[model samples]
Target chain A: MNETLNFSEHRMGKAIVLTLQGRFDAAIALPVKNRIRSLAEDGSRRIVVDLGKVSFVDSSGLGALVAALRYVSKDGGDVRLANMTVKIQQVFTLIRLDKVFKVYPDLESAVDSFEEY
Target chain B: MPGRQLEYSARFGPNLDNLILGADLVARFREETKVNIKTGDQIELAVGEALSNAINHAQAVGDDAIGLTMTVEDGMLTITVDDNGIGFLPDEVPQPNFKEHPSHGYGVFIIYEVMDSVSYDSQNGINTLTMKKRLEE
Candidate 1:
């Protein structure tokens, strides 16, 4: 029931890592989307979204991810998801969004995927 | 097919907080009914989506609050979300292009995906969306 979306950022080599905790619902999606946009504008094109602590996500949250992907991809970069809970994974699979984004089991692996490219 | 039944309803201002309230309502229902975790999650997400839609489209209609009803009976759970917004034809709302990575239209689709049945009715300035899911023993 907590509406607060705490977004923390870290830098790993060339990638901007964002860790999100709290409900990624309609109330918070736009703000999160704006943060991603700002990151992309700051030349942090390669982004890793860490959702290990995020407890819930709806269509708006998924939309935020898609919007982030579009923004970063325009700069020849991408947004990768990591540490998604099984509940989050279920929602993604139901919407078939699992096919849209590269999801990893942990942040280290997600960061590694970007390093390999 | 009879068991202990429960019904609850609430009316609240159009806002995202009510969406979270809707989720809590589902969780409480799940706890009382002892439904499976997967079914509980599906119900929560579907109800949350419905409430989100209500908040997104609610118009200021002189204190007309969003009305939510949760009813569990006969091995089925039903949730209803009613709003005062100008109702559109549910059929006219296009399905989200999943391949295109569109974001907005997934709300209704998600409700459909999680619920066993969905229906819409708009009359006298109230738009009601009803969704049902069958409980597994």
Candidate 2:
């Protein structure tokens, strides 16, 4: 299995939208986490992580997202999740992370949510 | 033990690269068994979690290999991951406080969610985790 993780980013108003592709597991979680950390350090606080292309996520991935959430929330900003597969969503629910992050069915809605504040 | 049985197993180095290779082997196993995508994905996730724990948490003194065994029988698939490392009490694992945004400790829980049954054993510097799931008809 080719286990490479790559992400694409774009700006939706003030929110930095990142679309992550490939497995979100221990082997690749650190790089993804570092990217999010860099974004936060660059003053991009409102972030939306799109998981539509992500096929799987383990604890490490979950932890990375949680870390991203914490980083962005430090200054009254937030990190939101979008387009999680049912299986991936189940993991979030199992770990009770579903309650911790704002989840939307699509990226547009997620970006719209930030505009509401 | 209820239906026709097929077994495939292998051992590999206890590292992330080997874990990825093992996952490929598992994908082939699923294809050979005609497992549906959803159920196969579950198996992949469960076994992946088990192997991740073995690779990340189970540390050996020297170069100990992680062992994997998979058996499909009677509409059920079973996988075992063994590591020669220090073991911990499964029951003592704390539920992660996602609200607190903790960065570790969710591997085993994901296994429990994806597998039908999961159990662990440890003795003589070896920790073994076994997980089972019912395959789709």
Candidate 3:
């Protein structure tokens, strides 16, 4: 039941892995959107958001990720999601976002996806 | 527990920080009632969406607070979120175009998807969003 939202970033080859810890709700959506904007500005075209530790995600949280995707797509970049908890995946599926974003089971697979591009 | 009913209620200020408290309240209700994990997840998500909508749309009037009520009775769970902010037409909200990959406007849709029955009513300056789910036998 981690309710605090926090994130850390690191580079993996051509992709940046942003691991989010805690609930991804409206409380932190703006900061996350800004973070993604900064990453895109820094020439990181490929991003993988690891949600292994994310206990929850509301529409605002999902909106931030979609906003990130749109922002990067303008620069011919992409954002992928990885390690979604069962609950998180349920929401994605319910909203049909599972079709829009490439989702992976773990960090290794998510980073590896960038190699195909 | 066929005829027994458990209930919880709380009022939170119109602040994003209160989202955590809203979530904790749901979790507490789920645990106390021994709700199944799958159903609990659905309840949590639906309630979270409802609360987020209320909080985000809240007008910064003095002493504005969102009211949340949850109850489990007769194999059903119901959640009602009330706010004093100006309300909008729920039917007028267009569903997100999945093909276009829209970012916003999924909040109301998700609530409808997870809950068995959803209704919205605004009366006497109070807007209420009520959601319900049937429990497995």
Candidate 4:
């Protein structure tokens, strides 16, 4: 019910790690969108969204994530999702988003996918 | 309204908690009404969408309770979600298309697609969204 979303920057060259917590509902969907927009605007193209801590994601929540993926990739950066739950993962698989988004088992590998970051 | 009526009601939080309870209500109604699987899923998703819409847009606080009611009459299921909060124009709310927008906007769209009938009425501080789905095999 009470989940927190956190943004962390690892100055490991060109990669940014964003950690999402709590529930991703319509209430906070816009905020997530704005955050991703800002990050992409700042030139942090290689982004890895850490969903290991995200507990719930409905259709709206998934929308925000999908939007983030599209926005971040537009400027030569890629977004990868990591540590998704079975319920959330099933949703992605159901909609075939798993194929569209790069999913990783852990943040380390997801971040390391930055072409030598 | 038919000669017979079956009803169930519950109050839940203004967040995702209401969503779970809403699903439960629909399941119970399906079991009692003995509706077909396709009809049951339609009713279940329609009611669920209405409850989610109430909780997401209307309720101000997390603990604020939304009342859900399901009516089965004339071989059809009617669900009503009532919230003691702000109301808006059902016409103004944009329709959600999963192919175009896989987001919260689709809740009402899903309701309309699955339900046989749908309407929203607001008066004296109560928002009532009623949806109906027919029994089919």
Candidate 5:
């Protein structure tokens, strides 16, 4: 298994799906935040982050997602999360972030939700 | 016979990359000790937060070494993270308002929520954060 955090992006209808793999923590938070910022600035109003393969996420990772939401919100866009593992879900629930971000069980649902955005 | 006690300890340089190394150590500890995956996940999360906080704080002061120790005994798991950086009062950190959805200040909060109890102390320029969780039989 790839130990380092990595991501890839692809267009799906009006939404941009960014799939993240490996651990998401302080080490890669800045770059991930920057990538999300660039995506929002580049006119992608609807962004979906796929965390299916992400094995871990700490506060720094959550902060990056929150920052992404704030950045896109400024552009009238929204950032959604998809496919969080049970552990990731637990962290989000513990911090009550589950109520802040629109989370979907799968990437397709996340991408599809953008139709209303 | 009394339950076997397990212990592990190590020190790492002040670097964010050590976060991963610390986590891997926890994973190995969990595997060797036969900790349940669910509890192990929480332990890893809490320890990761502690290590991250220490490493970041240590970087600000200087490249100091961070110490980590984990011990399991009597149905309890204890973790202690030590650093040479300036430490703050744990009680002083306000509980993050989930309503505000703030982008920062969630590290300590996460650690507190995951661990059963957390405490902080500083002595002679060394700061230590101790976290504990109850383990299931």
Candidate 6:
């Protein structure tokens, strides 16, 4: 089995876009965690995390979101999620984290929402 | 800490809440592994499910504490949890494959999807379960 959790960074206008693929479970913890942590290191405050490519996620994944949100939001910046798969979305609803994190349909709208806010 | 090894043992009491304890442990692993915070949350949930299964089925004692370990070598990571409960034949326990169960129901199936590798071995009254996945290419 492939051992790496796939992550890519981009920009939706001025917002940072993070795309994730593969299992976001305990087995692939550190790599996934460090990537998100460092993404917000720059001066950028508005961040968008897209889960369209993610196949599965558990509570640990949710905690990761909380951590990223906490990290970026410290300076009035926000971490929003977009393009979540159904299964992943279920995990979010189960724990009511969907409420805590702003979720959108796709990358475009999520970043656009950033402007609306 | 890319090639770090983490090990710890936890007790599983029948009345113990696996979700609570597993979540606590997985949370710490996130910092230990220093991976993506979001992925760490997923790991905690997966671990919680595994611990619950071990507590309820692996050992009759469910009251007995469970042992767990997470190790990172290179970019690969593995998490293992073991229990002293009466073990069952791996073949007998249903595989968590969507094709096998379809839409009837599937927890083990979901577990399999969320992780890259899942294995179990029961020997001498102890059952060891291991899950592995890669953090980066």
Number of the top candidate by lDDT? 3
lDDT of 5 by residue, B1-137 (tens): 02868888888888888788788888788878777888889898898888888887655354446989998888788899998877878899888877888898898988988899998888998888999998888
Q: What are the candidates' individual DockQ scores?
A: 0.68, 0.54, 0.73, 0.14, 0.67, 0.05
Q: How well does candidate 6 reproduce the true complex, by DockQ? A: 0.05
lDDT tens digits, residue span B10-79, model 2: 7876677566766777878877887877677778878777888778877744444788889888978888
In model 1, the fraction of reference contacts reproduced equals 0.71
Of the pair 4 and 6, which is ahead by DockQ? 4
lDDT of 1 by residue, B57-128 (tens): 757244447888988787777789888887767777788886787767888888988899999998887889
Q: What TM-score does prediction 2 earn?
A: 0.89
Ten contiguous residues with the weakest lDDT in model 1 chain B: B56-65
Interface RMSD, in order shown: 1.8, 2.0, 1.4, 5.5, 1.9, 12.4
For model 4, report DockQ.
Answer: 0.14
Which has the higher lDDT value, candidate number 2 or candidate number 5? 5
The DockQ-derived docking category for candidate 2 is medium
lDDT of 1 at B91: 79
| Sort order, TM-score high to low | 3, 5, 1, 2, 4, 6
Q: How good is the docking of model 4, by CAPRI class?
A: incorrect
Inter-residue clash pairs, candidate 2: none
Off by over 4 Å in 2: B61-64, B98-101
lDDT of 4: 0.69
Which regions in candidate 3 have their CA more than 4 angstroms from the true location? none
TM-scores of the candidates in the order shown: 0.94, 0.89, 0.95, 0.58, 0.94, 0.50
After TM-score superposition, what is the CA distance of residue B69 in candidate 2 from its true location, in Å? 1.6
The numbered model that scores best in TM-score is 3
Provide the interface RMSD of candidate 4 in angstroms, 1 decimal place.
Answer: 5.5
Error of 5 at A26 (Å): 0.9
Ranking by DockQ: 3, 1, 5, 2, 4, 6
Backbone clash count, each prediction separately: 0, 0, 0, 1, 0, 28
